[model samples]
Target: MESFLVLAVLTSAARAQEVEWRHDYTFARREALDKNRPLIIDFTTENCFWCNKLETTTFRDSAVLSLLNDKFIPLKVSAQLNPQLTEALRIQSFPTLVLAAPDGKILSTLEGYLEAPKLAGHLQRTLTAVTNPDWMVRDVEEANKAITAGDQARAMGLLKSVLEDNQERPIQVQARHLLKDLEKQAADRLAQARQLEDKGQNAQALQALTKLLKTFPGTQAATEGGQLLTTLALKPEVKQEQRTRRAQELLTQARADYQNQQFLCCMDHCEVLAANYGDLPEGAEAAKLVEEIKSNPEWMRKACESLSERLALLYLCLAENLLKKGQPHEAALYLERVIQAFPSTPQAEVAQVRLSQIQGQPTQQTDFKKAAEKEEGPAVP
Candidate 1:
């Protein structure tokens, strides 16, 4: 019986890991609410040490789970992983707890850690208010329900009604601001679609561009939208196809630079990729690479390099980081840098050996000019 209890406990924990907790609010819009249940959100992040500890410690406590599961649809979101959702909810702190209505109006938000019993008490209190009709969540909830039902007009009408009902309430101004902010965001996205197409990301850029031009033609993006249509008309469909492939290659090379610890070069490549092809696969890839290496010391140093170190030393540091990381493919790149930038340095011999290992060749060191012409870029020793 003791052994059986151990297995059962482990099995339950594993099952809990399979729960879909982190999700977008927009995704909730399409979900059929229980109407009987309230929403409980636990926003977290992979990088937050406290959040990880909470999951392993407090959240894993059986009593905590029992109360949460019974009272609310316990949801978890990684704030870092889901940035848009984080921004939508104005989340500034990790381990944010939001008690929400089924229609998405927040009942309350708690920021930071809460011990088991306190957390359970908070949920119970919020549940009591949610179950009562006189609570402000009702009208706010109704307005969001309209938004979910694709009745934007009705949603705005409901919001207007709520504003009148809550005229003396402090949240009335905040509600008005939310409406304006939403409108501003809608306008911004339309503008962004046009800006994207203007730069040549036809496939990734066109759908939103076309939609905005149709839906909000009097907006600034629509006036600028003609330039994109003109560009599209001038290009052969074949050129449109070629852009994606080229963007992919650039993005791949940028990621290689990052993995190799050539931080500044990697970031530079990504910036060029994103700016030129923000709607393309390469642009997306570039953006991801940028975010991944944004915090690296090598990246920061390279970006701040003042040329105090000889060029060879820079390449050597880059190569060492890459090699330490076990990314031989990227390490080879920095080794080449060392050779071209500092041929006379004592490190050149080690770089040569690394290159040989990279290519599985007997070492016959080549000169920088020959290396560049053969490799199609500057040969870093």
Candidate 2:
């Protein structure tokens, strides 16, 4: 009789529950990526009553089990154990459900207890949202259009977006092929620029590299070209020659604007020339032009009114660099200028945070980036 009861209990236990949940988040995340499916992450605490209730009840439902095992990768994580993941996801409550795309983008987050039907409904809706039967065809078609328009940057961006969104075999094959072709063209241009540089035709090489950078801003070739461009710009001979030529170009623009009585535009060119090539003869020329403008009270007033708005970005950039170099005092002076003079600009908003960091902290060792790091949200139970 005892043996018969044991056998019956074993049979009942075998038929009891069905959800195939992977406990390790890392393994499940890789599985989701490989399978090109979304993930359902269940966050729980060790002693949470609702989490236990969820494990025993809703997870046992056939519909939920089928959906999880069939359409989505289900991962169970302990909130107390995976603090990093919890903080990154910004979780703030127990029994939270995070539905994420294969690329790790959160599709939906649910906090508190969710019944079997509601959870299943949420999962089904998220699945429907991510299910795109035409993303492959649509993106490739748009990319081809961009390529035809001679916009290689747009084409590369579109192709990259496709590769990131979907990992299906067919889409992956086509997107990579197109991306490789675009990179090939960028590479050819980059090679031509290098040839010019090798021949000591520094000016022509700079022009070619600038064009390549503009045409393929995100490609590997453009990245190499950027390094080469910096190298060429750093050479004493190249630097001197380029600065002279560029300053002359700015002076020419300033002169043309002066002749047209566009004193504000003339001031803009003068400011750039004075800031960059201040020791060059063009700096004296720019100063002379500014002096000529100041003779006209109306022109000087118009320039003073317009120049601050344009210079706000430049000042903000300079302040950020100073902060990086542990010179917060200098950085703060510029930051204050942005806040006080160009308060309406987007740069002013950034400046306020950086300025506060300088005032709030005792040391000058902090950077704007560190000050800009947002505080974490409330803790998850």
Error of 2 at 307 (Å): 9.6
Q: Which sections of candidate 1 miss by over 4 Å? A: 1-32, 133-381
Give lDDT tens digits, candidate 1, residues 1-381. 999999999998786644335366545433416445567777887778777766777676676666566656667777777888789889998888888865566778998887877877887776665553343446667767765775544555555665664432324544566555445645686668667666766665666656655644444555566566556646786276657767877877887877777777777789888888998777887888888776666667665552324466677788878878888889898888777665544567668877887789988655534655675765566
Q: Which stretches of candidate 2 lie over 4 Å from their true place?
A: 1-132, 165-168, 264-281, 287-381
Candidate of highest TM-score: 2
Task: Identify the leading candidate in terms of lDDT.
Answer: 2
**lDDT of each prediction vs. the true structure?**
0.67, 0.85
lDDT of 1 at 193: 68
Candidate 2's TM-score reads 0.41
